[model samples]
Target chain A: MCATCGCSGNEHKLTAFLAMKKPEALTGLTVATLPPGARPGVQSFAPDTPVKTVIELERDILEKNNRMAERNRGFFEARNILAINLVSSPGSGKTALLERTLADLGARRQFFVVEGDQQTARDAERIAAGGAPVVQINTGKGCHLEAHMVHQAIRQLQPTTDSIVFIENVGNLVCPSMFDLGEGRRVIVISVTEGEDKPVKYPDMFRSAQLCVINKVDLLPYLKFDVQALKEYARQVNPQINFIEVSATSGQGMETWYAWLGL
Target chain B: MHELSIIQSILEATTNAVQQNGKPGTVETIEIEIGELAGIEWSTLEFLWPAAVGDTLLADATLQVRWVPGKAVCSDCSSSFDVRRLYDPCPGCGSHLLQITQGEELRIKSLTLVDKPTVAKAPLRWN
Candidate 1:
């Protein structure tokens, strides 16, 4: 319908739509990053904020993310897929272990890969090429992936008999340990490239990990990583943690690792 | 890092609250209190908020944070003391057998949205 005597509304609309661009990045949010300043305890914005104002909303928005994770866990439980979350630094052989597991049990069991990275889809691409269904989630400038991200990624993946969903979290030794991704097991993978003191330095990551993977044993001879000392430090943090020494490149101890996964 | 997902959660809860309260329009602000030990970066949440709740009720809402420090209690003395995330041991007794008393909480206390009933300027009626 033309208003004002003669213009094609469709053309005008199309032109407007074509000219539309992505939203300009937000400003004024920089102030939000700072800690709350004490001001007799009231943080009133420019205008009156409606909805319950009797008290400060001491809420964690991640609550719903956690709930969604539980639902995903239930879904996995129903299908008998032991969802395992693997967190580690980059090049800790998280994908290498996956590749070997896929090679060993590709025909025997079902598996899927949920790869998370700040950028690049190479890991997911590799996992998918290894005969396992994989979904790549790019977290761009983000440090870690949460359970809800895994839930969203898993929804698109095809499920199969005795399936396993391995959520390879972003390479982070700090923040990833905090968020529970509804995994049956949280496996922390570390390579010899990182010092043996890593377990001691980053205890929270190792303490919460259900299993610790000491990967890249083939390079152990090439490096000075103390295997026994690393194991002892992990033991000090977590009295009882299942761990294994493996070389994904040489296929030295991958069988034991896979056996633990019941693959 | 996963604040994008967290933003989605805020939107869902805000939407439900809106339906219950019968409010309309975008959420101007959604406040949340995160424990220091909750391991969430305030900057990260702010960064991901827009992306996660894109054009939703909470799209432009401010994520107000309340930082609550962690506390641990002594099993021997039953006394509670402040605790740090990276370190172990109690500040009161210097004992490592302390249990977490508070500060590892990840819960939504409440949300703030525009109430339509209030906005329409209906006369206040006493019950």
Candidate 2:
């Protein structure tokens, strides 16, 4: 039975990735390791008098995640950390954009990145090459980055107060939107090569994001994507959403993007 | 698949619910409420139920999922209405500034369990 809620069940599994060199830095840090669930049959037995009992437990299944998210939120608030969760589909140029951002302001500002992927640490390597302290989280079989994982990553990174921390979620549009990593802001990246109606198709992602970045704009001259129509579609879903078009490769409209970040 | 993980969570939660009651009995019925905006596919969950609970305490337990439709309220005009999708606009004001009032629920409602036999059912002799 769960101590928080009177539910008797196995614990949901999670995997946390942290590489400690000295091992002393790990002191005081309680890493939530997600190591890795099924159904069973019913056995009926003769009872003297069958007693049927109904237990009312209006417990939210996702409550555990939410509770961890609140803790993360408090941690960020106490430290004055600006944690941004960047989400989008695979190949949406999330890493490319991050590389550019790091290369541009890495020397001026102390930025720490928590890179989430299903398998490799390639993205983390790229961010490090671009001149930023980065940690890689490999969520094997897990579709999205849960708050508990982020909390562990934060403890490992130990980002400086008032510094910027970017949580590049696994390239998924659906599941990442549902799980909040206690980010100060959520930015959804959409490329011109993708369908313009993505906002409508993935309404939850667009609705939850505070900003929508239209990446790969340099390819706009070649591709037949309607930029205005895409923005209009996004607005139909979230009236208060902000947008910025940029080409991470050509550095086009990067200043505007940086300005929005208040760097 | 994410659905697989969701099934695991359900099984774990149900098991916990059963143990807390202090009665030895396999689960008879497990009821859960999932809202439309909760981002779960009902058919998929239903399809994965059997394999998920194959040999656990709830193997023969009946699974009941109550789907709650998405609903929202218009922040601009204070209009309450049912929302089919997150992008739905206010019916009265047609404003995108709508606050979600309901839906997006994923919870374990209740569990029904049968008492397990503690001793043989033979008639008790007068003491």
Candidate 3:
């Protein structure tokens, strides 16, 4: 209906802009090679030919994702499934904690893990060793997995009645906080090796998380990490956050971690 | 990272809309309204759209993303300010308990396409 008012014509005239196809659906990464254009009748603004003021982005990039996420949440709710998203910096032992969790809970309950990373099926393999259905989402260059991405990955994952799906998001504390993968609980994992200042440094990640996992507790003796300070700062940012301190390697503190997972 | 899949959902929705409207010869552009605090990354969405479209019916379609600002209502002063600026404590009084109203909607508002000009008593060209 030419809703851009008449701005489409202006976009067509951009300097040697490569012809592009608008996507009907997207997965990992979706890039638009062109810029927005202003059209008449419609108030949609467009980039000028040579110069223009900074475009004020009025679109919420996550809108479509939330729709699919809502659908997913509904599906999970109908089946009484609990989905937990695990976020952390690299080597915070997300997989390890998950592995321990599955080991402790698999006999009593069913659990699955959907691993997201820029590369590698390694985490998936590790979880598979933990005796659970595992799905790996290789984002390539992407830092987080959107709901649609998880939706597709869920198909490959073996579904169970009242299942718990733990999504190990990409090894980033920043970008993953921006995207919602339709999980009920968001758990941020941090390791003592990364130092205690992480919670203060990455407040957004901690603020967005419903739970905080401090992994590699056994190594506390070797490092200069202050567990007490980290916990305090994390509490300051998120007062009601659930904290779990564990050593996924030595198996110490795993019982409490499992308890926190409600396993 | 996640935007490509979102674009896919938009495509699926629009394609259904277009088909229901009687398959148009070509699809032009899709207009969507995105609000802040929707927790989506615009740069990533724009960065991953081409791959999502590829050479489908939307191969030539345009993705117009409009950013919607988040309005925060100060619990103390009952004033509204932009949340992105982290408008500390309402200008009237210092209060951090702000309630965010609106600015979380992500939806397809409408679409644009070129069809045979509607004319009465004029020969209709299938082209």
Candidate 4:
């Protein structure tokens, strides 16, 4: 019985063909060409012959991606670059806050932006308007930007040493939490329009974040959202979570926000 | 969802294992260990496994996912306990400082393959 699809046994076949019609490809190739376990000395069994064998390979599934992330971290450390991963849900004003940040601190420090989205270079354009080099990575169907994508973006942007690279992750509260993009710190941005329970609702994102920016505090008087309650909820999820309330529109509390970034 | 991508990874890992050890037959069983904190949906993985592994060496392979429970150690009290959620506090100390020791596992443990049987004929009487 086919456990996955409930298909009968007659259709599913495990037989594979390793046809090397061009033997020269094999002769000239080094050990790198073979799949990990099929190294030259390590035995490779044919799938056509009937012999019961168990292959023991205790390997981490995310190890490859994590290794790439470590490589990115090494790159960042070597260059003395402060990489910050900005995560939040859609319409959380991440872009507006970033715009204010670049304009206010542009003269003090160099900035590079790695904009991630499912479509459009719109965010990249906005960041570039603020006089920073930006690389936009369209993830297509991917929900989050992986470390490798950020590494590629860094190669393209090549921000100078001691510069700050802000990686604006895809507007997702869940998927981006599991991915480590070699950032020195993770900042989660939330707006006043969002519910105070957002931290508890998406505990993973809040717990992984080092700082939380409660954006759009200027509208606090008109809205029913309680800022203190939101902070308390966030703290309940992450005891070490630091907060900065700001409004990108009115430029409220942006100084403290910049100060947190050591700008 | 990202489940599709994860399934692809699992398929790639399985293929590598099969190519290394499978003996000219079919894969019988594949055992994978997934922890509670791996953030994968079990039903979604089960739904996508068939289409993802179809036409590959992992076709018809029995996928056995061993779910590992999340375990953590409290930094303040040094008490070990189960972690049901990301924000779960230490039972003894109520501290958020926790070092997760397990349950983030996403690994392929082993695979069983049945190769083509090599039948032995009676030894030749005449030399």
Candidate 5:
């Protein structure tokens, strides 16, 4: 008797029974007859028999995304757009910084925004209210934004030439680090409320970022967050990273931030 | 997880390769190389593999992975060292200004395929 879905003896009966009752088991069955002069236990390939072939690819797994990003880069370069990708952990005050920046420099520069969130149009609404054209991308179950999504957003927004496009990435630090959004600069936002060791803990984000914005400086007086230590840690991970300390709510250091933006 | 997306990309690439190669044969094994600094969790990838490859060309194919270690060279001291994490400073100069030389790879190395019996096509030519 067979061990699984027991059907004894006759080979044809056993195959038919398993095919009807447990079709998956049929996959493991070798019902084909052997070729002439082929031994039962030993294997031999005839001169004309088809053989296994190994195809060497050695191709990057993210080739598709990288190609798309290059296309985006070309698009931005042709239009003279300064594309900035903002990445951070959730509740790190990315929207607040954008809101303050838009409010302060709305008269001086033309700004376009691409907001990414797991689910919501709230950030896009806020950007629109600030008088800048914006598009919100709901990733559904996606943890990070890809270049293709930003390309689509740019098409929808139809940003003019020589403008700044701020792509506020989905508020996740891990997965976003691996994706290149073809941005002119990649800024990482971290508030004083979070741990000072965030840089070392999530080194990939800091290592890839060009600018590190330390937000919520207004709340520094009440908290034990060491600003110097945070800066040191960030430097350890990324020696070339520039820092700009700001409090979006108190409007402190906004001028420096604007200056960094060349506005 | 990002690994799921990576798996999907692998599947798409494999499918495209098969189509481009004139629908050669059924895949037997796929070999991949993942670096330590690639930002992928191997455990999560393993756990999600079956579901991600189900009903795809890679369903019955065996996955063979090769892990690559991280390596970096310090700019200030001009010394090379093994890097396990990006936060690791240069051992010689204690400088953070290090250039990564390796261990960021996420690539498909090769695919082994068992050819179909009916097709008598010429051998594939590689440049």
Candidate 6:
């Protein structure tokens, strides 16, 4: 079982790949000694070696995920749906912010949520309480939600056209930034308690995000978190990233967030 | 960590490549390119490489990685520079508006497969 999420660790096993392996034939193979300090992109083999064949494959490692993400993008565009991916570290208040948004704008807008967590359907339950259809994806041992996962969730939710879909990705600062879920906008949330240097520490997440939501502003006075420094640091990484400060509990800056959402 | 997942993807891609080549005996070497800004830690990837490929076809494969440096062009000044971090600013105008020209590459460049040798035919005995 996974120590972090309390689920079996084989959730992400690609069965097709596993099944493709043939029994090993370990006989009659000549092992050549490679030159010391040989590197890729440099010629390391002799042309006369008839036993070896080099296959050139300039393939992207994330090509499969990228293609799936593009398909999801096309699906969302054809239906005129706006999909937003919410990403952040654990306890950055992504679900809380979504709850406030669904509660405040449910009457004015059609909202659907695809909540992602390593375990439990608690976030989905909270989203359902707000009257918007929701689908919960338990990633098991998977650290981040990939495009195919989101595609499956979208299918299960069956959100209507001209609606908004919020994909609350598994709360991770690093891994989730590597996978694109075909969201129209990627938002990174940071709370006052997490400190101002988060952007610099996790530049990849900050750089990929289009918007930065500074949560828990009500506790700003109690902590020494410098909001300006955080914005400056975030801008240093991503100059075009927008910011919205809010306290979901007190509804401090929910209006600005709503306006940013155009709801 | 995510490096394990990345390695899994690498193994899967390599496995598919081998299958496409009519099930080459074994992967001898796998060449890959990883950019400086690909959001991967080299140490972490290297650390997890052994165990991730232990049971796969790549278990005995020589893993070769080509490191690509991050490069970006300043949108404001049209100046190009090598980037070490995402927060790097334009040297010409000190502006943060920059367009990434290169880096962020995570690719499998090539694979070398060794075919098993055929059994030697016995010379006909002359009586």
Q: Which candidate is the best by TM-score?
A: 5
Chain B TM-score by candidate, in order shown: 0.75, 0.85, 0.76, 0.86, 0.88, 0.89
Per-residue CA lDDT of model 4 for A106-154, tens digit only, reads 9999999999999999999999998899999999989998888998999
Kindly list the per-residue Cα lDDT of model 1 for residues A1-263, writing each as its tens digit: 54422445422211001112223422222112112343222232322223333223444566665777788778888888888999988878899888988888888888888999989999988998888889999988767887778888887896665788889999888778867778888999999899887876876688788899889899877888888888877765565677898988899898888789885
lDDT of 4 at A210: 96
Writing each residue's lDDT as its tens digit, candidate 2 over A67-180 gives 888998888889888899999999999999999998898877789999999999999999988778889999998888989899999999999988889999999888888787
TM for candidate 1 is 0.68
User: Which whole-number lDDT from 0 to 100 does residue A258 have in model 2?
Assistant: 89
True contacts kept of each: 0.33, 0.64, 0.10, 0.60, 0.67, 0.63
Query: Could you give candidate 6's per-residue lDDT for residues B18-109 as a string of tens digits?
Result: 88888547788999999999988999999999998998899989999999999999989899999999888898899988888888999999
Better of 4 and 5 by TM-score: 5
True contacts kept of 1: 0.33
- Full-model lDDT, candidate 3: 0.70
Residue A165: error of model 6 in Å? 0.5
Tell me the tens digit of each residue's lDDT in model 3 across A21-140: 233332222223233443222122233332212222233435577788887777778778889999998878888888878887899888888999888899999889878988999988
TM per prediction: 0.68, 0.82, 0.64, 0.81, 0.87, 0.84
Report lDDT (Cα) of residue A77, candidate 3. Answer: 80
For every prediction, compared with the true complex, DockQ reads 0.21, 0.32, 0.11, 0.32, 0.34, 0.37
Which residue segments of model 2 deviate by more than 4 Å?
A: A1-48, B118-127
Candidate-wise lDDT, in order: 0.71, 0.82, 0.70, 0.83, 0.87, 0.86
**Residues B1-127 of candidate 2: C-alpha lDDT, one tens digit per residue:** 5566677777777778778888887688888898898788777777888998899987988888888988888888997999988887888988988888778888989888877444322222232
lDDT of 1 at A242: 79
TM-score computed on alpha carbons, candidate 2 = 0.82
Instruction: Report model 3's TM-score to 2 decimal places.
Output: 0.64
lDDT of candidate 6 over A1-263, digit per residue (tens): 64423446523211111111223422332333344344332222222223677889899998888899999999899999999999999999999999999998999989999999999999999989888999999999888999999999988888889999999999999999999899999999999999799998999999999999999999988999999999999999999999999999899999999998987
TM-score of the A chain in model 4:
0.80
